[model samples]
Target: MGDGLPDLPPLFGPVFALREGGDALARAVALAPEHGAGCFVWVRAYARVEAAVVLEPEQPLAAARPALLAAAAAMADALAALGPPQAEIALRWPATLVVNRGVVGAARLAAPPGAAETAVPAWLAVGVEVRRALPPGVEPGTDPGRTALEEEGFDEADTAELTAAWARHLMTGLNEWQERGFARLAGRYLGWLERDPAQAGAARRGLDSATGDLVLQRPDGALTRRSLRAAVAEGVA
Candidate 1:
């Protein structure tokens, strides 16, 4: 772990910084069962980054989806705070984060393999990674659909600062979820979802608080649901 990490809130035990090429999510997941919750790990790989926090929930694993979503929303809020006023930060369904309409980062959730949905796992991990700087020899316009923080005018926001901000914001988000209920967190997350203007009138989409599923409703009264848990299990975005 690296030094000089900002003071974290009470819920987060310590900030463990992984060396170059280290996988934060993998380390956190491996240690979670033993260390339990409040263990946060992060890695600052050149232009890429990785982070994960361990969580221990009293509720069953199936009911823990809200916690994961709240963590992702907190991360989004952290990025939004560091970004310029006009910069657009949004979530792409379950995991990806879009900035200025371009892909910049993503979040992931993990638990023990084959852990029963109805049983609380020994531990859970929520990991996130964002591109801090452009890759070498990569021009701004080379990949218009993708972007890095520096390329998007966030030159002052480095990986360390963002990681610290994420910890603080995540603490706030979890507290709000506990006090105000999941609806409040869900509403904030929904606001950050990107939507196409042309399809705005075609259907309405929302997140199911209970199961963390994407619910879509059409004008014809047809409803479709996509499960976040299933996506996590299948390792799909």
Candidate 2:
């Protein structure tokens, strides 16, 4: 916590910090192989909260992938704690995160090499970036479609504190998944997930426990699925 650096918990492995221009996600992925589980890497940037965590799962990739949802849920929890009381935050299925209707952050996942849906991955790296503040001279609400923590009334949202909060929440979410069940984790995620107001009664969304896919159920019982594995392949979470 000194000098406002991220203070990671004891359960985590080695933690690395990158300069403003470095990519936290890429570096974390690179470290995942050698550092193994619980390795954390982050960029101490001026305008965003950027970080990633390495994990080794006991379950197969399919089952382990729900960790992405846990990460997303963790982000929402982390923000809520530091943002204005009762501030609005939502998860856009798969990866995107919204703050007061503007895209503020996102999470991405990386599966280990040679990983298959049924295989237990050697490691997985989950990276997240949140707009902490705009560069000096940038005006808030200049673009309604994008936002940052400072612009959203999160006066107490220090980058280091927020990052530490996220890591703690992520660990708690995963532990709940392992001990209580995926249902436990899914509930927290779904609670923060965004829904189409126009199609309120026309569709429903649920997560497939085994594959971590998003299932959109139509009123007529027709279902559309979004693959978590596919998102990992496409380089997003």
Candidate 3:
């Protein structure tokens, strides 16, 4: 499949393709310990655009939150590059992409549970899937919030092109994350967050000093940390 397609972009040079389809997550996790870092796996024939990146673990997986956030920010950057206007695209907190107010796709990250963050991880995988085409016979307004690129008039974007663009953006994000800090990444991500009623009456939108979690400070001076982990687990912001 990908053989007949055009070449992948330069940034994704380390990609490896799988011949059989069993479990991409298992495959990625199994291979991560060997290749170490920057190893990627891509499956083109599948229904989704899937890939993974490897990272060494230094501390426990829970402590790896900042790195996970960095990877997520990287994915958001990748999606933004394909837009008609750069930075106009953004991700809803907890892993949803809202492009021009429409859902383009989603990104998922994985690693061994209880793995260390500061130490080289056994392996880390970040997979992204974009709906290039809609299920046949599906009509608009049937699902107002759900959409594919084809439905939104992005006919020019093939899977390969999107994959390449994502790879480039991801690398840029990771580099920036390592060089600068999460402050910039967090700022970019915060700009794209969709407003929710749960955050009304807060001193600020969602700023928390403790563990960098989003918090709501009421007029009564009560501060509660908005559980981003729970939000991510439920796939909502």
Candidate 4:
């Protein structure tokens, strides 16, 4: 692992720039106990950028959902720096980044296997992967489900610059969460979600602080509590 990356904001944690052979998640998690929170593991892969950040396990993985959302918002800020056209970039719940209405990449998260509530946690890690280049013969909209920066007309950008920008934005957003709490992060993320007309009947309610669930009250006097845990486990909003 390499270190000493300047320009990455301090809250991103310690920087561990990894060679191609390293495992991104494992590398970040390994540093948690010693490096403390915000330790970052950035794995440089050809044509793709991947990274992971350490999350201390004071609560179950589910309880960290808000921070997870904050991470995604930070990535959006990074992508915006690439000069994506206005309104061209958006994030799909629970963690997919979309460009021009096509999926460009997604975020993946991992915590200690079988982590339990009240367990101070080994650490949680959130990984991000963005495709920079496309393989030959794979045309945009070929999948109608995926895309890349190059395909999106972001050829002027490169992985190094992009990764550095992401580290900064992510750290800044994390700090905001640390200072002000998850409500701020939730507001930003909730703004990105596409409202479902079908769910119009489900009165949009706020998250339950006690259980960390989103409670939707229906117009018909019915109430539904959706577990933030289950939503995050699937990793989609």
Give the per-residue lDDT digits (tens) of candidate 4, residues 1-237: 434344666566667888865777677767777886778888766677778888774554556645566666777878888755663877765677887777777666776778775454677787777777776788767787788888788866677677777777777766676678767666666666544453477756555543346566888878877675676676564
lDDT of 3 by residue, 1-237 (tens): 244334544444355666434344455677777766766676664335556556654444544444445555555665555544533465665667665677766666676677543444565676666666667788765777777666666555566666666666666666665568656556655666665566677665553322336666788898877665566456552
Best by lDDT: 2
Per-residue lDDT of model 1, residues 172-217, tens digit only: 8777777897777778777777765533554777777667787878
Candidate 2 local lDDT, 105-155, one digit each (tens): 898887867788788889888878898888788788788899888888888
Clashing pairs in 2: none
* Global fold similarity of model 3 (TM-score): 0.76
Off by over 4 Å in 4: 1-6, 20-22, 57-60, 196-226, 235-237
TM-score: which is higher, 2 or 4? 2
Quick one: how many clashes does candidate 1 have?
Answer: 0
Residue pairs clashing, model 1: none
lDDT at 138, model 1? 89
- What lDDT does the true structure give each of the candidates? 0.79, 0.83, 0.59, 0.69
Residue 77 error for model 2, in Å?
A: 0.3
Look at candidate 2 and tell me the lDDT of residue 211: 90
> What global local distance difference test value does model 1 have?
0.79
- Could you tell which candidate, 1 or 2, scores higher by lDDT? 2
Per-model TM against the reference: 0.91, 0.91, 0.76, 0.81
Root-mean-square deviation of every model: 2.0, 2.2, 3.9, 3.1
Model 2's lDDT to the true fold? 0.83
